[model samples]
Target: MEEFEIDPQDLLLENALRVVFKAAEMLDAEALTPSQLKDLSGALRDATEIVLSIETACGCDHDHGDEEAE
Candidate 1:
């Protein structure tokens, strides 16, 4: 039997995305107060940073070869 392994960076990115999605859902519920909204905004920002960091660590560049033309 063969076992498959998931990359740690990929797993971290997935979890970060999940956190952002959950925060979005909370924002969509329209039941939070102004303070809650501010806190969630911070949480979302942190999650986004984590996702970007993981992408950088994985060498997933977003340039898409456009820079080469310049």
Candidate 2:
């Protein structure tokens, strides 16, 4: 079997994505007002950019090339 290595930044990014997904799942997109939808969209965009930046800074691939299947 091949051994796998985990990068701290990769873990962080994964956790961040999980949080974002959970938050999204909790909200009813169809029921959101226009303004609220806009705000949520902006927040998600910001979160995505921040996570991407951190991944880059840590030299981790966007696809988490080094991450093992859980």
Candidate 3:
């Protein structure tokens, strides 16, 4: 089998997905009987929104190298 390499952006996206899953697991473990599910769901929704925002903001043509001399 060949080794696989992942880009930094892929790693970031993976981490974000893991975090969202973990957040849901944590909420389940906490067993917040009194609290409503809306809050926990909202948190996950917000996290997804942030991920989309990052994708949009970074989806541009920006160079990593220094600018050329005029």
TM-scores across all candidates?
Answer: 0.66, 0.50, 0.45
Off by over 4 Å in 3: 1-4, 31-50, 57-70
lDDT of 3 by residue, 1-70 (tens): 9998887777667767886888778777877654556666776787787677666667668642334442
59 in model 1: Cα distance from truth in Å?
Answer: 3.3
Leading candidate by TM-score: 1
Q: Whole-model Cα lDDT per candidate?
A: 0.79, 0.72, 0.70
Candidate 2 colliding pairs, count? 0
Give the per-residue lDDT digits (tens) of candidate 1, residues 1-70. Answer: 9999998877777888888889979978879999998988888888889876765565655664565698
> lDDT (0-100) at residue 27 of candidate 3?
76
Best by lDDT: 1
Of the two candidates 1 and 3, the one with more favorable lDDT, higher being better, is 1
Report the C-alpha lDDT of model 2 over 1-70, residue by residue, as the tens digit: 9999998777778877876886587584557778877777877887788696885576534566445554
Candidate 1: Cα lDDT at 26: 90
How many clashes in each candidate?
A: 0, 0, 0
TM-score of 3: 0.45
